[model samples]
Target: MSVNVITYDVGTTGIKTCIFEISDTIKLITAAVEGYQLYIEENGGAEQDLKEIWNAMCSTTIKVIDNSKISPGSIQGISFCSQMQGLVLVDKNGEPVRRLMSYMDQRARRELKEGMGNGLKISGVNFLKLLKSIKITGAVAASVKDPVWKYNWVKRNEPENFKRVHKWLDVKEYLIFKCTGNFIMTKDSAFGTMLFDIRKGKNCFSSKMCKLLGVNMEHLPQIAGCSDKVGLLTEKAAVQLHLKAGTPVFGGGGDASLIGVGAGAVSMGSTHIYSGTSGWVSTVVNKRVLDITSMIASIIGADDNSYNYFAELETAGKCLEWVKNHLALDEINIYLQKICVSDSLESLYVNLYDFMLEEIKNIPAGSHGVIFTPWLHGNRCPFEDSLARGMFFNISLETGKRDLIHAVMEGICYHLRWQLEAQRKKIKTSKAIRFVGGGALSPLTCQTMSDILGCEIETVDSPQNAGALGAAVIVAVGLGILERMEDADKLIKVKEVYVPNTANKEIHDRNFIVFKSLYKNNKRAFRIINK
Candidate 1:
């Protein structure tokens, strides 16, 4: 009577593998995390080692099964939720041709500009092309961070690689192919490419948009339904993962979509905020919506025949990682080395984030007038400015490390607040928004988000595991273990609720005006200085 599913959540910074019991109320049996390095270079180049990612996935899956003492045979299926917009090119042999270009990469700014020049004029995209794109896709951003730009960049810069590429797969699809020997991606993953007819909600590429973008559609993979079983796990992959062979592999979804499902946002009009490496404010909606000005747009959702209205911030937990690496690592290394830890750097890096959260709890809202910008790698939503840079404005002599730290957290919350405001312009949001992500694990961030946004913030147990759970839920639905994805509402148990602090509302409101103006005031300057 015991049935389980292993879901792998492949995020930008790492992979988290979780095992879930398939039932009326899904239970998370156990989980394990495996980390990887992101190679970031000047002029907006960010990449990941694809081989290491596969290794991380396999190792983490083994760790979860071994740690939980669960029988691999009991696992009815396997699925995935992965970071969207990353481009992974593979050869005819299904081997990675090169490292993946991350969603964080902004190298195609020039190309995006060239596309939207006198021949066209829609800021990031061509005006005429934009019209058709908006009509069919429901959303279109001609940014270098999008997979289309990455594909174009590869074709232009590495012509040899482009010719050799047998398929252009998103991160999740690459992993799926590794397990099932099928080159496939879900509608949600394809939506991230900005080359799909989102309005039609088709599980295939858009030839019209591809023609406009000058992208060869031949390189793309076949699109599949979010919960459709793609194929059975291969014997080779089963041996590597220490799992049973012939396990069903379902077509999972993009990280944001799955996270929405995992956060119990399966019903229309339900909303949730996820802060992982990147962050977003997403709401499930029945109708397609697009707001290019506010950068709030519709993308394919994990649930069948649904869409998600969202605005994304490119950096969230990533900013915190920046702080840890640049600001706190030295002190942490010394402390850990004193404790005789062999790998002090890694040890401090892994365990110090929770410590940082504990320290942030004592700081008040607004960080005592020290406002930080969470745009270290530029922003994607509430505006489409890639040249924007992160800053800790209004720092005074009285400011301390705690203030700087809290400001970073508050800065991310402020951006989310901006996104929430933009999303409210289109539709009604839920009374209480659920929060899920690795970043959502921090009580301080949740409280800060609630205080700044003036809304109730709900947290579920294992917030970091939301994407993984969502992927498993999709598998359960595909296998008829669950009737509907909406049942996630009953499956997800709310572990905590963060109420807004009324006393701090005035400062947040006052600072929000300043926060809103800071970008506009510096827009020209950022373009000049950064470019």
Candidate 2:
């Protein structure tokens, strides 16, 4: 018998609702997307309205269900794969205490300093605290953007709201509560807080780390496995989503945990590159590891007794989105009008990006010495610098607009290669890495990534829905359609593969060296300019 499930892949800027029919293999039935704003404050604050996000999820869910012509009763379960590290505080009524504090928010500088500051340090974090956290969680929140620091910021700055906090949760946890009316945080989301005792089997929140970090243990919610059935759909959520009242709701995971599964990188030592709004290089590992120098760590995964050594870039496809608006607005507008004047063409922004990429395929690798940095919203992993801003370097009078465009893409790929190399330092990554995300929809991007990273790039069908597909897999496991999460690779099939082009190796190699130096050489200057 075929089983159908719904998954919401909640991203930084939007939510993607996908329906999948899982039987012998996973099949995408219908998908719908709705975008919400990431409200940016002047004081290094970033937030999203929980109501808006919830509404978007509801709207997309209804759309996908109606569009697919599938009986809503047939949907076995609903799950989510959300952006990690967000701070959402809920009260007794299960409503958000405040606007959701985004993972992009970096206003916790004061809390970060007071907690992990100057006296004795390791990798810029307090030495003793780092050791304790590494021992307990196998990770440390050296980056100010972590949920712990955000939790600290609210406690000190918004004391009244802090008093009202009933439970602390991440992005997925908030939605999971809204759907099932149960307070739960998936294990992967718990691990992302840098407070969960990875060494402990269950009830793993570490008192030592939480006490040292000043987070109240009472506010932590009960932990659930990624595929564990949290509860049935609440009557209110069912009405809003046009689904059955008692549909099972599963404990979905964070993007970092499940996107790899969607890309079919589920087995141990399987590596994948995800280039979405934000991007990362993640390798599934059997044992936990930590790299403080590179800000990379093997975090708990959705699968039992597994981990992914994850390295991230804050802005990957976001950089491409940036260039589309600022650098190639004219070309984009013209292309949109040529295809369809309405939002239909524009809604599929990846198509516009592919149109642009098609225009620059012949622009040569490395953009003829012009280089761009993918740090428009700052950077993470390898170097944690919010002051870092993007730039187009080595631009000469001879440089054309196309060259600049190509440079922006090469710059993004170079950053990915840099991260992949960092993971290689601790573990062996697959030579032919699976590249999945909206960015992977472009053949030129696949080829460019393969060329710049000097490896084969593999892509799967519906690459853009990899996160949601991964979530569907979790739901399938929960519903007994699949035996385990590890069976994900058996369902997903590779659609295409690209091999590296040896001819462009020299230029990319030379530019990548300069690209690596851009930060080290200019980090001090970046702080000065951005400050």
TM-score of every candidate relative to the true structure: 0.95, 0.96
The lDDT for every candidate, in the order shown, is: 0.86, 0.91
Worst 10 residues of 1 by lDDT: 332-341
Report the lDDT tens digits of candidate 2 across residue range 267-374: 989999999999999999999888899889998888976899999999899998988888877654645345333676456544678768878989988888999989
Where's the lowest-lDDT run of ten residues in candidate 2? 332-341
Task: In model 1, state the lDDT of residue 423.
Answer: 93
lDDT of 1 at 226: 90
